[model samples]
Target: MNPALRLPAAAVRTAGAVSPRLGAAVAMPMFAHVAKPRPVSDDDAPTMSLARGRTIRIPGIDRRGVDVAVYEWGRGPRTVVLSHGWLGRASQFSALVRELVAEGCRVVAFDAPAHGGSGGRRTYLPDWLATYAELQQRYGGFDAMVGHSFGGLATLVATAGEVEAARAVTIAAPADVDELFRGFQRMLGHSDAVSAGLRERFAARYFPGDPDPFSWLSTVRRPLPAGAPLLVVHDEGDRVVPFGESGRIAAANPGAAVLPTTGLGHNRILAADVVLDAVVEFVTAEVARHPVSPTTEAAAPLTSRAEPVGVS
Candidate 1:
């Protein structure tokens, strides 16, 4: 059977089950596969194995440790951290990393808990945020941070006064978690009852007090910190995440710069020279305008290169 055809068939099978209990049981695992990410591809191996990088493990929410694959390049004073989206690894930012490094800035990027060289099979929004916090703790605050797709949203949430950064850039990011859930539900052709049940289970497990996880995680509801500048870049023809989502982010962060690209879609936007140049320009300008205080700038410099290390 065609892979695309299998999901709808499974949804029908689960929805047609005689007992709701049976339906929920059957449906939950399918949803988990959708939410959980797969490893990076063979084609991405060479880039993922980029030299001068190190991997480390950090304790995440609930004290469950997650391995984070990190790549560091350049030796400039300012440090920029990069975060990749769902199913995305650190090396996806290879182009941007080079650009930032050439601009005389240190660049750091990491694979999320369950993606790339990281450990575990399941990950959540909190895990992504926790990973950022752990990275900040180790490397100190960032001069600028860039996140792509879901990573972009995670960056926004993590940097909400929790982690400090001079400026932030979000690329092809979804503005609302609710909308993401809705899209997932639609993709699986889940019925209303099934969708409601899934929501209940998710909320109970991930967010006990919050009835609406979507609204709770919405970037618009929790705006970025005051005086922190943001840049939102989205492709006009992006099929994965609607361009309107970027608009929502820009509206929420009135000071944010919304840069719309023409041909580059979701992932390609990362490699586009125009996009990379824009990012470097934005960060450089922002850093100069709002320089990190001497205290914030006192953190020790990152090692230019290191062998990847795993935490016990």
Candidate 2:
């Protein structure tokens, strides 16, 4: 269960007229600066020691074009998909991707809808899940997946029922979607009614299946794929995503393991040695134990879900 905390009064004060849309413009710059993603080359592949891979265009439900970046390397039979957090590009995981590739794992990542090179206005959970489904249809089933922050939540939803992945990993992911809506509303100083209205509209338009963010915390829990292993890592010191989120995930899935960490807040966990190592170890171990069949090796999974926790 998610450990409860008193919501800070200051965190929810009203601003005169800042809208969620406007708040994004103001907050994105701040998030970009603090995210501190390393520079990645234009191609799907890594430069220097890193190899560039492939890019594919997926037609969106809205008739818009969406693109996903794919990177491949190593001689291993296993493939892994890495999903970045909110407002983050797949390249943010380049450091960990390189490490995984060196270990003989083929890695793939997406820019999401609006972030990176992909085209869109604001993104929602449904958009992500649709793109994820398209990729899975093309790539088949992946051995493991690692998602950071919002991507972690999306990954949980994406992998449920549709994907055939053997294991999953979430870093600083949220346990509840409502917490995110609340956090954003608080950040922008929106009134509760206004925030609820805006969030409901956004989800209905973009994320069709998502339950009311408030009720989904308990209702929309992402169940682990049958027989699939799960590992969750979160930092207690995370200022963005509370560590309690990870606790909820662990509580929901008895077979899932949780690693509570310290110091690394949200994005920094991407670069942290301990966190990446844990992910790599988990993926490699799962792959070794349940090796992908030779014929169906190159494909990625449909999607899966685990309980979500709020981290914003």
Candidate 3:
């Protein structure tokens, strides 16, 4: 824990000594915190503006409706859903949106609650799952779903026999949902009691009837749709989520392709030309191909099956 947060960690520990539930009640709010808002980058501004007239009003964590900014491009038969990671926005997939559109795919990407232009302050995996549920209903079925980091895990959970999607791809996603909570506990330097309480209360609130919260929340526990091709992309050098996570996901979902890159870390991998190529290719593998324009062919994925992430 940071020196500044040590005091709070101690206080939570003291509270846990009395009752883990009590400590968790106090820690839940912080656990669901969203990072400081990030301005849409200049490169992504144009794509960001595309969501101006397209937005979804979904219930927030409190049940109050909130407007989530959604960006759409193209009008092809295949509809691909893009999910940005925690603290990430829709425009982060600008490069991907362009490619999928060029491949004649109707691209749909949204800013989750409490992130980017979406409303609210705190959000969790369930919040993201709910948003996707709403979209799945509206879209009827999705041809492909691509997500980064936290969004990656949520993507699989949402699509596991719930949403109708043909294929899935994840970038820098964590393997075990339980490990995510455990990692959070480590980050906050919480005591065992406080950490246990956090899971107990969280499970009670979000996963009623499921004694073990992550047993259902996990992708491994609920593998992707059978025969649904999955592409797991991860950078070996990622510090946020380990590279081994992709291995775990691949191992659980046999025949799943594992594309390992280096140096792109977590967020930056989203826009890498190689990552985009693998995703678009896998997403559109079944559909009849579209001809690439001269410009696109000229700038083909800079990295081969061997090289790493790029297009920065």
Candidate 4:
């Protein structure tokens, strides 16, 4: 723990001692909060400038509408959808965008509500999932879906349902909601009771009338679409999300491939040429083998040029 964050962590523990629900209340805001949104970097500017920008308003959190900022590149029939992580904008995918476009693929990416040029201040997983649903409807599905960190989980959740794509990719993504909740609990130094209460509130708010909210949110429980090939790109030295998470994701879905890199940490992995190349090659393999069309019906199995091995 950072020396600076210890005092606040202690305060959360004290609050939990007072009442579990109250402690949960204290942590919910931060857990659901989106930190300061990252602006487009200088390296990302040229690609972002080339994207045709637009907004699409959808039903959002807290009983409001969220105007999602959507960005697109290329006009090819082979479409790829990009999802940026929490506190990240679509611009983080600049390098990958250029690669996909150069291969004759159309790319669509969005700033989830409250991130980038979108609407609102706070956002959650449901909002991210909703954005995916909305974009899929408008664009008539995709050839591949790529997401980083939080967005990686979102892409997984999207594949579990109706968001049809020929292939999927996740970069440094957590495997389950429980790991994320536990990490948050550790950060706040909250008790088990507080953790339970937080889930209680989370379920009631986002998944009312549903039992086992976490089941719907877990990638293991609802593995990726059966036929679609999945590439789990994770850095061996990632600090933000554990490297082994990709292992979990791969295990849950048989035939998934792993692309392990070094020294990229969490965020830097997004800008790495190796990562971009692997992702583009994996994402476009379906197109090279078959047509760009991705139907709900089963298609040919996904085969990737990347090795299916992991880091030690």
**Residues 1-312, candidate 1, lDDT per residue (tens digit)?**
548748664764566355554555566555545234455556555555654667677654335676777778888988898998877878788788777888998888887766777777666666666666667787787888899998888777655536678899999998866666565656656566666676565566655554454553567886676567899999999977889999999888878899999899989999898899899999887453243333431132111111111110
lDDT, candidate 3, 99-195, per-residue tens? 8888998988888877887777666666666667677777767888898888898787766645667788999998767767666677666678888
- The TM-scores, one per candidate, come to 0.81, 0.72, 0.83, 0.89
Candidate 3: residue pairs that collide: none
Evaluated against the true structure, the overall lDDT of model 2 is 0.62
**Best candidate, TM-score:** 4
Q: Candidate 4: where are CA atoms >4 Å away?
A: 287-312
Best by lDDT: 4
Candidate lDDT values, in order: 0.70, 0.62, 0.74, 0.78
Considering lDDT, where higher is better, how would the candidates rank from best to worst? 4, 3, 1, 2
Give the clash count for model 1.
0
What 10-residue stretch in candidate 2 is worst by lDDT? 302-311
C-alpha displacement of 116 in model 1, angstroms?
A: 0.7
Q: Model 2 segments beyond 4 Å from truth?
A: 1-49, 207-220, 287-312
Candidate 4 lDDT over residue span 1-312, tens digit each: 979668877777788899999888877766776666787899999999999999887666654676889999999988899998878899999998988999999999999878899988767666766777677678776788899998898788777755667788999998878778877887778999998998887777666655665675678886775656889999999877889899999999998999999999989999898998898889878542212335532132211111111000
What local lDDT score does residue 215 receive in model 3, on the 0 to 100 scale? Answer: 60
